[model samples]
Target: MTTPTPVVFIHGLWLHATSWEPWIDLFQKEGYDASAPGWPGDPDTVEEARANPESIADHGIDAVVDHYASIIKDLPVAPILIGHSFGGMIAQKLLGQNLAAAAVAIDAAQIKGVLPLPLSALRATLPVFKNPANKHRAVSLTAEQFRYAFGNALSAEESDALYERWTIPAPGKPLFEAAAANFNPHSPAKVDTANELRGPLLLMTGGKDHTVPEAVTRATLKQYRHSEAVTDILDFPDRGHSLTIDGRWREVADTALDWLRRQEL
Candidate 1:
């Protein structure tokens, strides 16, 4: 029997790793070995993460990339990477490093070379930037703030429900690192985008996403222009940043699965 391909799902800030549970189950049903591992210092559950926010603070982009790298080393295969938001950024870094079979980055955060900073993107992250001290702390989002950042394309009722179920305090360091990526020559937000031999990558963007705007994703695509590797972009013009966790999440997951199949991974 052929060995099933493994898949790793990475979540972005303010979301517990368990938010990928549905995706894991769906991928397993489709014959993939799927798992969603938390970031460094992340508790196993949302309740625990909420109660111990301090444990989730102070981690930065490089730490997160290393955390996932350790997990990948133990897998039977390099695995396919599917990440959302900041998770998406991590996926690109791993893929660019040739650490995965392929990667699907959904509404990924801005990498080093990405330049457009839409007003909505800044507004969504204002809570962290407003206080410089947040860089060393974990920050939680209010329901209204969550609505603006993640669920603007969703109904107030559904958005609030998602907030209650999956939200958790997130470290602010990665945001600061990405914000200063261009200025910092050693920015951890850097990705190898020029690896011609790296695995294929598909970047997905939501037109209504406030947090990681569509323009940012488009620019992220351009970063790979120097490489001859396969890099593709898909636009969900009607979805928001919550596309991976919201009610229509199946649509996004199915799209990713189809892409993976096309790659014969």
Candidate 2:
């Protein structure tokens, strides 16, 4: 029997790849090889990551994308890509380059063509943007900020628990890089939406997400309407940026799993 295609889960800022463990386990149980790789220099655990936030601080979107692309290149078969937040943006980039068989981007960071820069989005990024020096530093969020950006849909207790387990510092460069990508001639935030080989792309949005809200994800979908590939959007009405790690994470995973099964992958 042929081996199932590998599934790669990319993580966003302020969280390491381990946050995908539940999803990885679910996918593995479904007979797919799954992995969630860290950005270069990521620590082994959240505690270690918090202690050594600077380890992955300097790597930008280009660096992180190249890291995952290299991993996919070494796999035995073309992989399905699933990413959250910045990982979502990275997933789209890989798909555009013909690297993935399919992709699911959840609450993804803005790309070049996305136009709604909501005020909530700006507040969510204040930890990094409030300090110009953060461009070269790793930025960590306070519990309040995390609640606002990621756990807005969860109760206070639930949000606190998640913060203790999954939250960490993130490199500021990628956010800065992607924010200016539309105008930067040398920006690494570009994607070739016209690629016929981009396969199927799905952008998942959260109704309660402050960081990458529905408007942002919808705009991303509109950009891909020009692509020859099949592009779609799925919105979780009661979710937030923490959709993948929250109590109803299984619901999100089930939706993605069902979508993949429909694609016969």
Encode model 1's per-residue lDDT on 33-152: one tens digit a residue: 999999999999999999999999999999999999999999988999999999999999999888999999999999998999999999999999999999999999999999999999
Cand. 2 Cα-lDDT: 0.90
RMSD of 2: 0.9
Candidate 2 Cα errors over 4 Å, as ranges? none
| Steric clash pairs (candidate 1) | none
Residues 160-185 of candidate 2: C-alpha lDDT, one tens digit per residue = 89998999899999989988988887
lDDT at residue 100 of model 2 (Cα atoms): 92
lDDT of each: 0.96, 0.90
lDDT for 24 (candidate 1):
97
For each candidate, how many residue pairs have backbone atoms clashing (under 3 Å)? 0, 0
